[model samples]
Target chain A: MERVISKVTFDLAQTSLRQVNHFLHRELNSETPKITLLNPDGAHNLAVGLDATIDVEIMGHTGYYTASMNKQATITIFGNAGTGVAENMMSGRVHVKGFASVSAGASAHGGLLVIDGDASLRCGISLKGADIVVGGSVGSFSAFMAQAGRIVICGNAGDALGDSLYEAVIYIRGQIKSLGADAQIEPMMEADYQTVGELLAQAGLSYQPQDFKRVASARQLYHWNADADQEY
Target chain B: MCGIIGLLIKQPHLRDSLGELTVPMLIGMGERGPDSAGLAVFTQTLADPYRKYSLYSGGKDFPWQDLSQALQTQMSKEAELQPHGNQAVLTTDLPSTTLKPWLKAHYPQLHVLSTGRAIDLYKDAGNPTEVADRYHFKDLKGSHVVAHTRMATESAVTPAHAHPFTAGEDFCLVHNGSLSNPNEIRRKLEPRGIHFETDNDTEAACRFLEWRMREGDDLATALQKGFEALDGFYTFLMGTADKLALVRDAFACKPAVVAETDEYVAIASEFRSLAHLPQVKHAHIYEPAPEEIYVWNV
Candidate 1:
C-alpha cells in the first residue's frame, strides 16, 4: 500500500493542541508529509519538538515558542508569531509571513528562520548557530551574544545592535541606530557579499548586496584586560 | 509574569459593548495571570461636583440600602447606590473629602476602590473570569478601560495588592512588571503627605505619577520623568478621564502589543488576548517601543 495522504487539515477549533502535537510526535509517518492547522487563535506551543520531515502550516497567529526545538521540518505561519518563534531549533526552516514579537530566534542552534515583516527587540539574543533573515526592520539588542552563524536584515536596525557579539555576523541594508559594546561596522569583503546575497535569496528577498554594511565582533571584549579601567 | 490589557473605543457606538468585548481579553491571559484581577473603566464624564465612587465590601453581605440611607441622612446629600454582590458604585454630588471621611468613620470595612467623575473600578482576590463574572463585566459601558491580572511576584495575593491602582482623581494605572526601587520612590513622596496604601510596587508608581500630574506635569511628561526616576522592568497601561496611555521601560524587558483600528485601540501583553477581537484580522498590530509614551484620546 502507498499509504500516503497528500494533505491533512487539523482544525484547532475542533481538536485540542495536545492531540495535534501528539499525533505529530507519535502517529505521523513519512507518508503524512503535510498538515494544515486552521484557527490557531494565538495558542502556545502549537507544533514544537518535531523530528520528522513534514510541512506544517499555521493558519492564524501563534503564541510563544511556536516551533522551538524543531528538526527536519518546515513550519510556516501565515499570521504573526509571538515571542521566541523558533528558539533552540536543531535543524529545519521556520517561515513567518507576518511580523514577529521579541526574541524571534533566540538560542537556536541550527536552522533557517525568515520573517517577512519587522521583528521586535532582541531578535536573535544568545543565538548559537542559526541563519536568520528579516525582510523588514529589527528592534534593539538584536544579535546580542550570538556565538555563531549569520543574521541578514533587509531593513533598519534599532539600538545596541550586535551587542557583545561573538562569531555571528550581521549584514544590514538600512540605517543603524547604534551599535553595542565591542560590535562595529567592518568593510564587506567578497565572502561577506556572497554570504549576504545567498541568505537574502534564501529569505526570498531581492536586494543589492553592495548596499549592505557588515557588522561583526571587534574582539576587544573577548577576554578581560587587566590594564584597562572599565573602558571598551 | 502578569498580564495587562487596555481598550479605548474611538467610535461612540463601540463604547456600549466595552465590557462585553473586554471579558474575553481578560480571560485569555489566564495562563499568565491566574491569581487576581482588577479593572478601571472610564465612562462619560459627569458634570461638575458629581462623582461616582466604587466600593468593595470584602465579600461581605451588607445592606447597601442602609448605607445609602446613612449617606443621605448623615451627609445630607442625595446619593444612589447600585450594588453588585459585595461591590457597589455610589454616585453623588458630594465632595470626596466630605464623604470619604464619613464613610471611613461609619463603615470602616468598605474599601474605596476608586472615585472620579468618569471612572469606576473593580478588583478582587479571585480568578480573572470569576472577578469579571462577579462584577457583571459584560454589562459595563465605558470609553476606555485599564485592566490587570496579577501573579504577585513581589506582593501578596490580596485584593488590596491587585493592580489598576488609582490616586487623586480620574486616573488609574496597571503594571505588568516589578519595580526595583519602590522604597526609593516611597522615600521621596511620603514627606509630601501622599498617603501609602498597599505595599505593592505598583502603588508607588501610581502615587509618583499622580503627584507629578498634581504638580502640573501632563501624563506624557510625568512618564518621561518616570523613565528616569523609576528603576525596574515595567510595561504600564494607564487610563484617564479622556485619554489612554501606555509606556515601557528602556530595557524593554516586559512585552506589550497594540492593535489599533478605526473603531478602537486595544493593548495587551500578548497577541493571544487580542486574537478574538472584532475585525482583528485587519487591525494594525505592532509592539510598543521602549521609552515611548503612546497616548490615544477618547
Candidate 2:
C-alpha cells in the first residue's frame, strides 16, 4: 500500500535521459520488472536498443526515435511521438496510445507497432518484416517501398499509400487519396481477411475484416522494360 | 538544419507572458541552430504618423542618447529612443521615407533591423540562449512572435544573416529549409525596387512575400504565389501585426509541429522546442499538412 508494487520510476526532469538509457541498455533484471518514465518532454532516444523483455511505460511525449531497435521489450508511450518511433525493431511490441509523427515503425525487421491515434506522413516507410496496426487515419505516403510486412489501417489513407511496395501487404478500411506508382488495389482474399483480423485483434480493434481493401505492388517495376519507350 | 518557432497569443491576458514562454522555446532549439538566432515580436499597433524602428549598432558602445538628441533637434518632433546596449527602439512621428534617408546620411554604421508600428526585432550571431539573453527576449511583450535559430547553411554567420527577416512594415518571416531558386527570385525582384540586404535564401523568400503583400495580395494569396514561385523544401513561419501564419512545402521534408491551446498557438520545427509551453500537454498537437496555409489571428 505504501509504494507501487514491481515498478521503478525515472523522472527525466530530475535526471538526464542518458542515465535511464544506460540503465535500460546495461542494467535490468527480474528484480526490476516494470520501468516507468516521467516527464519525457520530447526527449529523443528513450529506451532504445533494449534486448531484454521488460515493460516500459513512458508518461509524456517523446522526440525522435523512441524505442528504436527494440527486441523483446514491450514499450508503450502515453503521449504523442515526434518521429520514427520504434524504428528498425527486431522483435517485441511498441505501442503509442496517442498520435505519432512521421515514419512510425520505419524499417523494422520484425516487431509489432500498435498506434491508437493517427500517424503523420511516411508512417511505416521502408518497413521490413513488422506488423503495424493504426486505429486512426494515416498521412501521405504510408508504407512506401515496404519490402516485407503488414500494415492495417482502420481509418482513411492519404496520398500515395504503399508506393513501390514489395511483398508487404496493406489493408485499409477507409478511403484512399491515391496510390503511388506500381501500388495497386486488389480484391481481398481469405488469407488477407485472416491477416487483418489477427492484427486488428492484437491491436484491440473490433472492425469487421470484410470492410477492408487490400493494396499490394503491381510488380511491374521488378524488371526493366527497354521496349516500352519509358512508359510504365 | 535550422529551427523555427512561433507563438500567437489568443487571449489578451496571455500576451504579458509571451516572452517568458518563448524564451525557453528558443533556447530549446539551440542544438539545431547554434550559430545565430533572431526573433520578431508583434505588439499592439500604434496610431497613424508614428512608427517604431528597431535599430542595431552591431556593438555595445553606440551613443544612443546623442542620436536621440540629434533626431529631436533636427526633426522638430518628440523622438524617444529606448536604448539597451547595442539595441535600441526609436519611436518617431515621421515616415521612414524621411527617417531612413536621414539615418543613412547621418549614421551609416547603424543597421535598421525593422521598421513598423507593431514589430520589435532582435537578432545576433551567437547561440540561441546567448542571443535571447543578450536581447532580453524574456522581457518582450507582444501579441505574437516569429523567431529563428540559424545554422548558417546558405550564408555567413553574421547578424545580418540571422532569420525572422522583415521587409515591409509589421510583417516578418522565418524559414527552416533552403531555397533552390533564391538567385532566380532575387533576379526577378531586384529590378522591381525590392531591396535585399543579404545573400541568404530565406531573405529572398521574406522579400518575395512582403512584396506580394505590398502589391495588394493578402497573406494567403501571397503564400500561394510563394508556392508557385519558390522551389525547394521549406517550413515557413510568418508573423504579421494581427496574425501568425505557417506553411510547408509540397514535400514537407522540413518538419513543423503545432500545439494549440485556448490561450496560445505554438509552432516549432520540432516538438522538443514546443514542449515547454504552458498547458502544452493538454493542447491539441499535430503536424501541418504539406502546401497548406494555417493562419492564427491575434
True contacts kept of each: 0.74, 0.58
State the displacement of the C-alpha of residue B180, model 2, in Å, after optimal TM-score superposition.
1.2
What part of the reference interface contacts, as a 0 to 1 fraction, does candidate 1 reproduce? 0.74
Off by over 4 Å in 2: A1-5
> Candidate 2: TM-score?
0.97
CAPRI docking class of candidate 1: medium
Candidate of highest DockQ: 1
Cα error of candidate 1 at position A117, Å = 0.7
Chain B of candidate 1 vs. true chain B, TM: 0.99
Calculate DockQ per candidate and list them. 0.75, 0.67
Using TM-score, give the best candidate's number. 1
Candidate 2 local Cα displacement, residue B235, angstroms: 0.9
Instruction: Please report, in order, the local distance difference test score of every candidate based on alpha carbons.
Output: 0.92, 0.92
Candidate 2's residue-wise lDDT over A33-103, tens digit each? 79999999999999999998789999989999999999999999999887899999999999999999889
Q: TM-score for all predictions?
A: 0.98, 0.97
Among residues 3 or more apart in sequence or in different chains, the pairs in candidate 1 whose N, CA or C atoms overlap within 3 Å are none
The residue-by-residue lDDT of candidate 2 on B1-298, one tens digit each, is: 8999999989998888999999999988999899999999999899988899999998799999989888889987678899877989999888889999999999998999998989999999999999998989999998999999988887799999998899989889999989999999999999998888999999999999999999999999999999999999899999888999999997788889999999999999888888778899889998898999999988
